[model samples]
Target: MVDSPRIAIDAMGGDTGLAVMLAGAEAAYRQDGALRFLLVGDEAAIREALTRHAELAEASEILHAPDRIAGEDKPSQAIRRAKTTSMGLAIDAVKTGRAGAAVSAGNTGALMAMAKLALRTIKGIDRPALAALLPTLGNNDVVMLDLGANTDCDARNLIQFAVMGAAYARSALELAQPRVALLNIGTEELKGTDEVRDAAAMLRQADYLPLQFTGFIEGDRMSRGDVDVIVCDGFSGNVALKTIEGTARFVADLLRRAFTSSLRSKIGFLISRPATELLRHHLDPNNHNGAIFLGLNGLVVKSHGSANANGVANAIRLAARLVRDDLTRRISEDLANFDTHKGPEAVTA
Candidate 1:
């Protein structure tokens, strides 16, 4: 039997609390029986929850945490309590090598802060970016980065994001040479802020990199099925991600209302039920639940605080896959190749 890496989970982190977290872990265990878990939270609560999942209970171990990071807590405040909180202990497991990766459905800011502080950035990486998979009309999902990690970034930061985003796409999407584009106001070379244009220029010049720099892509064209990786600063990227998610919900809700408007519409809905179901599945956030903190020395996956058992299971599965694939080493190798080929100099020139 293949020995899968043990995943450390913040059992008390999400809005739904321990029951959902344990259920999610159990679901993942059912999918991959070889998977193991290190559950971090109030020991009595975790133990109580596990009793309902006998198989998962046998496959898991619990670590007691006296505290929990509240949703309103600031990152700084959370950091001070790192050694005692479930979220903090989960991340520390990755840092100490007790777990291959950490997964938490907690405050985004606190999770990012704790993970960065605990794992630090990879050798050549200056900052880690939040990257996630967005459903697109394309054959594969698109990889978008800087999803609220760094609000303000320079040309160099954007360039680095492009590289890391590409590496993530290659690993998660299994692309040979991901087509990358800078998210901009327009596709015109002269459009967008100075940092964006500069990043585009640098990407265009760096032919030695594994990614194919396809110039700037507009926000409206993000889901057009052409680009594989979209790079932007946290300010713009966060706004874009939220907008995309909101629009998806809007469309899904609109369709439901429209189909129930009248008998005729309801009959039509039944006729198109198959198509609508596919569309619903495509827009479901649970299908794509994990957002990764790329460039960190160790892997850390952020699950939506409101995510359900299936969503949490998806996050756990994602963390396991990233560990098995050795994603951090892959990014480090690509970063080294970029430096060795004088990519920075080429970009500056």
Candidate 2:
């Protein structure tokens, strides 16, 4: 077990700058006083921000990082500055054992590049995938992976994603046997590309694994609460994620427009104000703010750049929970089990 895991925050990474980052850290500290922080950014600015949250001040340490990674910076460019940048140093802390995990609301690509370079992938895994918890109609949230980490993935990558995703579901969602599925064009056995079909064939035969392989899941069925984990290449995963987010926003805006269309509609909205408030809370992206880079040697969480303090806190909470649960070890063990069972070779054949 990780003893007293401390989360390293990239204070200068996001769109909201240091204020939101510090506030988010403070909010997380408030929720879990046992949590400690390593604030990485301009020393003077971070010190000034800490003055507002006495509790966080007591539980935190400041690390001076003279530079910051911009949102538009290329991954290659960002990697070059990893040594001096706040986002880079925060991830580096995890690699060096100074921190258990890193949290940043920075460029997703940069974080992925820096993290993969600094910590490297766990053995038996070729590449790391980005996974996030999305609110679903099911009793629990669904975990989806390869959210733009690797645009093109082969059968092996998808298989690795499923194992990592299952481990994450068990660790983060406390699921006993997560039902896993490949995101495909159709649920039929013969549908989807060759890579997906091959992966499915392998997963279907491997009943010995901890996760439940439920076969292919189409795009339309993603939010239906039938599966616990959805695996796909980054290209498809990113497109699906953006589509879902856009749809949510569209629905929310439509409701707003309808509610104030006329005086009668306004009154109706007020009468149903409580219900709408609940809906708003449920649909709020801030409530589900963290996206994790799985299959890495250390933990690194990516918070939405526009997220508020509450969102940042949620991301931090996720990182802390994963650390407490020993997520990295769990994934490693799962991968080892898969390899021992000859999962890859059996699937390929």
Candidate 3:
């Protein structure tokens, strides 16, 4: 009976389906005995899965949801079916204060649409951004935002993302006075679009904020580990994120082929197995499994749809950490303190 925050899980959402979700929940419960769960999905399937893990059954409560949003469903289509769907019910748990946060390995667009509609944006936020931790060459992970949430954004939107992203870095990465930057094609002050320039100007003038605004950062410098939080609209952020992931896979495949190409290479690979394993562990997507919908009233973490049990467990842990750390309150407080003239108050009613 270790007491911890309860997280809502959309049990029918992932690629591997209910069994993997339950297995992940069991793994999370085993790793952190304090954590509790609200498993939302088909009651029969959930119960069947739960029987395999008695301890998880003890720690979890199932909420039967007759339907589930599909991976191919568009955001517009998904939002209309919110009431009957597992993803919607999981998010509703957060809205109704029944759960501290919601975790889903579901349709990314659908999850975002449902969350935004159900929880609404935080008072000072214009749009919620999808933020995630990316492994960096430095000592800690870098927080990058608008990973695919808002494809088009203005200067004010970018500024809000900066504040939210910085607050998230503080809460999740345990960083003090995080260094923030805008992602642009060039590092020059005069480069990039008017939106980027305006956002940079605003951030640079925001001296009262807790984060240090380091002007512009080019995409090539992203992995250098100097900046803590990187902000950009969804279009570029998504492209950058996908490019990095593809490059990682390309390098990994090359390594595999090279190692098996020759007998001598295979021998060398055998000798370097330990180092290679360490590299694989570090680069595995499961280690960085959660992508958060920031700027919302509550925490909503979207795990990769194809994630295994280990990845789902990591996502659950992330939601739990944010809940315990009170991430929403921190973001709200930060926004409240922002100058009204330049904040969301100026743009939104």
Among all candidates shown, the one with the greatest lDDT:
2
| Candidate no. 2 TM-score | 0.97
What's model 3's TM-score?
0.97
Whole-structure CA lDDT of model 3: 0.91
- Model 2: per-residue lDDT, tens digit, 1-349? 7656799999998899899988999999888888989999999998988888777889899999999999999999999999899999999999998999999999999999999999999988888999999988889899999999989888889999999999999988999899999999888899989999989988887787899999988888898899999999999999999999999899889989998999999999999999989988988999989999998999999999999999999999999999999999999888878877885564222
Off by over 4 Å in 2: 343-349
lDDT tens readout by residue for model 3, 286-339: 999999999888999999999999999999999999999899999888787675
The residue-by-residue lDDT of candidate 1 on 189-212, one tens digit each, is 889999998888877878988999
Worst 10 residues of 3 by lDDT: 340-349
Clashing pairs in 2: none
Error of 1 at 100 (Å): 0.4
**Cα lDDT listed for each candidate:** 0.90, 0.92, 0.91
Candidate 1: misplaced stretches above 4 Å? 1-3, 343-349
lDDT of model 1, residue 98: 93
Q: Point out where model 3 deviates above 4 Å.
A: 1-3, 340-349
